[model samples]
Target chain A: MNPLIEFQGFNKFFGQHQVLADIDLKVQAGEVVVILGPSGCGKSTLLRCLNGLEEAQGGSLRLDGQELLGPDTDWRQVRQRVGMVFQSYHLFGHMSVIDNLLLGPLKVQKRERREAQAQAEALLARVGLLDKRDAFPRQLSGGQQQRIAIVRSLCMNPQVMLFDEVTAALDPEMVKEVLQVIQGLAREGMTLLIVTHEMAFARAVADRIVFMEAGRILEQNHPERFFTQPQSARAQQFLEKFSFVESLPKTLHKELS
Target chain B: MSFDTAFMLSTLPAFFKAVGVTLQVGVIAIVTSLLVALLNATILVLRTPYLWRLVKGYVELARNTPLLIQLFFVYFALPSLGLKVSGFAAAIITLTFMGGAYLTEVLRAGVEAVPRAQLESGRSIGLSEGQLLRHVILPQAGILSLPALFANFVFLLKETTVVSAVAVPEILYTTKNYIALYYKTYEMLAVLTLLCVLIFLPLSLLLRYLERRLQHGQFGH
Candidate 1:
């Protein structure tokens, strides 16, 4: 079967600095691909290119056999098919949780309010956030807000979901709740493109690990093999840092992005 | 000539009647300015191609020039060019022109103040520019700029004084007409100042109440 998402010789640049160089990657339907890399390794940039958030300067990016790398591309329609959840859980603070979830379905897709609202409530319940439906974002905890963020995207019913270090901004206690939501999607066979620094989650969740360094895919392999026997020296060195106990407050690491 | 207290008292009725005209121009101008400002602010924030540049140019021109000159241009210069605008029409147009540019800046700052992540997340779900605007951008912008918008509202109303130059026959126009006929410049000027205070005191209080109501409604805080 053809890959649901494919990138060939994909290139992106910021001025003279080329961030993604000749990237080639593919994900089959129902595949869970976790990108592992050090900070500023362009892992997030690769996912962003797929979401059409970052424009690729050259090369072809095809989603479900449709080329998305030209001026003629309908980014709005493309976005509907690919939902993304950000690290900070950027929910609309002014809106209720249900409003945040129903916004895309009702306004963008022009779906029926009752239908869209039912989906929103069901998804909120799935995330164990049904009680918070009428609650504003600020009234919720960080973890609760992030789950609502996930449901907000899920309400769109996208073909692929992108998690851009979603739990990176959460407290350690809050991280588990958010990660479980993604793991639930994976268990149900949702196609996911994840960029994360969570080494353990990467090992447990990823069907295949895509290790990146310096804007290039260094290597990719089964998570079991990649963890037990890293194929590259850099991958070995990268995993070693995670082996040590983390002592620094997460607030210090917040600046890493 | 003991301040002509009786004459000033009699003309109070005239100022009261003229207040209606002033308010008519103020209300219409406020609504027009708000609409214009919203459109321009959206154009600027969305980077809507050539139109953004045009809006920016209009904003700069309107902001830098005086309101009186703009009124003169609409009332005088346009007539010379065969446009022949009415006095009230000229007042509303010129006032909205000046107020729109100022309020556009106020609102653009408000819109831009919304976190960039809010916009990115909105786009992630395929919200068109209009959807993002209505659902995400404006609600936040409207609140963020509320205080400033009210301040500008008051400024716009006060700027109606300049419309008298166009023979708009608003409050200040009536006052000037009486001042010229009776030569009661000092007494009339005093009355004008008092009338302005009277017009604005209730308005300021009402706007403050509205600002609080909206903030509470939006935030539930």
Candidate 2:
């Protein structure tokens, strides 16, 4: 089967500084891909490129076999199918949570207000935030706001969801609830591209773990193998910092070298 | 030789009537200025290549030059170019344009004050550019700029005094007439000053109240 999303020879530059260099990858439907890297390794930029937020300077990207690179792409339509949640909740502060969720469906999708509101309430309920329907973003805690931000994107009924460290700004206690919501989505088999430092969540949830550095994907593998036996020296070193060495299965370590 | 108290008292009624004219001009200019300013501000914020430059030029021209000159340009210079308007019309038009320029700057600051993240969220949700501006950008800008916009309204009120140069027969125009007839420059000038304070003090206070209210609305505190 064709990959649900594909990147071929993808490259992005910020003036003289190349952010994504010759990136190539494919994501199958219902697969959860976690991109792991330190800061400024272009993990966020790579996720942003998928949604056409950061236009690629070269190469091609395809969603369901349709071209997604360059200015000619219908970004609005692309965005409708590809939702992004930011590290900073970015909920519309001037609006109530319900209004925040309803806006895209109502205005862009032209969904009826009654229908959109109904869907919004249902989605909010699933996240256990139905009571916050009338509350403004500032009235909610950072965790509640991030959950709302996630559901706000879900309201668009996106085929693929890209989360850029959605819990990075949350308090440690708050991070669990937000991750719980994401894990729930994963269990329901939603296609997800996640950039996160939550090693445990990535281990439990990601089908494929992609290790990246210096604007390139150094290696990618199934979660068990990648965690237990990192193929690249860079990946091995990164896993060591996470202190996975103590947990590394002996047989897997022999295969890794 | 002393102050003609009786003459001043008699002209009070005419001065009051002229105050109505002044208010009418001010009201019309305020409404029109707000519309023009909001549109001009959107243009300035959008920064469309050549058009933004044109708007920038207009803002600079209107702000740098005196209101008196702009009125003169509208009333006299435009007529010299064969586009004639009544003195009242000239005052309103010139005030609207001048107020709009000032408001563009005030509002552009407000627009800039809106968080970039909010705009990005709107875009991510697939809101069209127009929807983003309407739903995300403009509401926040309106709240942020409300106090400054009110101050501009007061500024426009005082600037209406310059309208009398074209014989618009507004408050200052009629007061000048009383001065001419009775030659009581000092007394009439005193009355003008008192009337201005009476009208403006309350408005300035209201502006402060509104600013507070909007801030409270934002914080819900």
Candidate 3:
């Protein structure tokens, strides 16, 4: 079967500086592909390129076999099929949580208010934020806000969701709730492309890991093999660095108890 | 030369009429200029190609040139070219033009200050450019711009003093005419200052109330 998402020899640049080079990756339907890389390693840029948030310099990107490059491509339609959740959870501060969710459904999709609000309320319940329906962004905690942001994207009923470090900004205690929501999506077989620093969450949720370095895919492997035995020296160094931070809380907990 | 409450009282009727004209002209200009500025700032934010050039050029011209010169062009120059506008119309149009540009620059900054993240989230939801502006950008920009816009509103009202040159007979016009006839310069100037204080103090209070309410998320009206 053809991949649900494809990046064939994709090239992206900022001015003369190349950010992503010759990216050749593919994801089957309902696959959760976690992109792992250090800051400025083009992991998030790769996800951004899929939704046309970043322009590509060369090559083709496809959503369900349709070419997304060049002038003929329509981004509005592409973006609707590929929802994105940012780290900052950019819910409209002026609006209530329900308004933020209903905006795309009623305004962009032109769905009936009753139907859209019903779907939004259902999704809010799924994310465990149904009680926050009337609260504004500032009123909610970071975990609640992130879940609402996820629900905001999910309201579009996109074929795939791109999560760019959605829980990175939350307090440590709050990160688990956001991760649990994402894990629930993975269990329900949602096609997801995530750029995240949460190594354990990535390993737990991703069916496949696409490890990147500089601007190229240095390694692509299954989670067990990738975590137990990262092939490249750079990826090994990256994992070793992350393992300390990831294991710190557990170690600290053991020491305290 | 003695302080004369009696003369101040005698000047009240003309002052009231002048205050009426000033407010009529001032409110119209402020409202229309706000609309114009919002439109121009949105255009610039959307980067609408050649239209942005027109808006940018207008902003530069309006911000740099004095309001009095702009009124002269509207009231004097336009009539010479056979487009005779009444002094009241000239005052409204010129003030709108000037405030539009000034506040466009002011509001453009506010629009730009809206977190790039907010715009990206809007796009992620597949909002059309018009929808994004209407639902996302403008609401946030409007709130962020309230203080600056109010400051500009007060400035535009004070600048309405120049309308006397075009025979609109607003506050300054009445004051000058009263001083000319009665030569009650001190009494007239004091009443003029008093009238301005009366008009503006309530407005400043309203602005403060509004800013606090919006900041606290009691958003409406």
Candidate 4:
């Protein structure tokens, strides 16, 4: 299958500081790719570049067949097809959960209110948030708010969903619920690119795991090989320092014995 | 001193007539100021190079100088330049220009208070810039701005007293006329203060109540 999104030699700078440097990556339709990295490794900036939220200074970036670097490129149109979930769960505080979900369909797609309401209801039900329809963002827990953010993006009927650490702000207990929602979305064949530190969720849900450090993809491979046998010394050292490699061997040994 | 019933009775009609002009000038000035402030604020938001500088300059000039100077400029200077407006018209124009400079800063704070995510969400929903401003930004900004705007109105009402200098027959002008004829300084000033208190107190109360109701409805109790 052809790549659904491609970033080639992408370079981004904020004044004198460079955020992303000579990065290259591709994601296929219906594929779930997870980028794992330490903080300030340009992971969020990479996602921002994909949706045209932050412009890349030099690169060839494309979504489907549309070029993102051209002078006449319509970022607004591209944003419609590319939905994003922020780490902070940026729901409209003034609007209800149902209203937040309905806004995109009604405003963007020009769907009738009744029709949009129906879709919103269905999506809310899918996200397991039907009962909280009229609740405001502040009224919900962090996990519920994140789920609402997910459904809000889904309401736009986007082709590719970019998640920038959706569960980073949630409590540990709350993290699983959000991860479960994302796992379900992955199983239903929605294309997803997640930047996260949740290795277990990535191991379970991600088709491909891409390791990033200092604005470049250090390694990319299938989840099984990437976690079990990372090719790059950086990846190996990273897994080792986290005690991830040591713990996994002990767990496997216990299972076998 | 014995109460002069006929003198007080005759003053009532004149007072009412002056009140009418006061209301007209106050309402017109407030509305004109709101429009001007909204336009000025829009220019500030756009951040266009020359236009932004021009708007800032206008705001600074209006704010730094006294209202009396602005009113005199419109009244005396404009007539010399071949635009002879009536005193009432000139007062309204001057008050609006002066009041607008202050209101722009008040309204601009409201506009800035709206979250960046809200604007992003509106754009992500495919709203055009105009639609975003009209539907999303302005409604929230208006609600957030009502308190400041009402405060400005109260100040503007007090400021309208200065129009007496331009010969507009508003409440203060009428009071001056009454004081000149009767020499009842205490009673006339007392009545003037009472009238202002009567008009503005309930308005202020009503705005407070509406503000509470809007907050409860939009943001929940």
Q: Give the TM-score (vs. native) of candidate 2.
A: 0.88
lDDT of 4 by residue, A2-71 (tens): 6999998999999988988888888999999999887888999999888777888998998997788988
TM-score of chain A of each: 0.95, 0.93, 0.95, 0.93
Complex DockQ per candidate:
0.69, 0.43, 0.50, 0.29
The DockQ value obtained for model 3 is 0.50
> Taking chain A of candidate 3, what TM-score results?
0.95
- Number of colliding residue pairs in model 2: 0
State which docking tier applies to candidate 3: medium
- C-alpha lDDT (0 to 100) for residue A141 of candidate 3: 90
Per residue, candidate 3 scores C-alpha lDDT tens digits across A43-152 of: 99998899889999998888999999979988998998999999899999889899999999899899999999999999999888888899888888999999999999
TM-score of chain B of 4: 0.90
lDDT of 3 by residue, B1-221 (tens): 49889989988998889999999998999999989997998789879999999999999998899888999999989988999999999999999999999889889988887898888889989999889888998889878888888888988888899989999989999999988998889988999999999998888888888787986673422
DockQ of model 4, rounded to 2 decimals: 0.29
What C-alpha RMSD separates each model from the true structure? 4.8, 6.3, 3.8, 5.4
Candidate 4: lDDT over CA atoms? 0.86
Tens digits of per-residue lDDT for model 1, A1-257 = 99999999989999999999889999999999999999999999998888888989999999999999988999999998999999898999888888888889988899999999999999999999999888888889899999999999999999999999999888899999999999999999999999998888998999999999989999899999999999999999988788755643455434555
Runs in model 3 lying further than 4 Å from the true structure: A244-257, B35-39, B46-51, B72-86, B211-221
RMSD of 4: 5.4
Ten-residue segment with the worst summed lDDT in candidate 4 chain A?
A248-257
Question: lDDT, candidate 1, residue B82?
Answer: 89
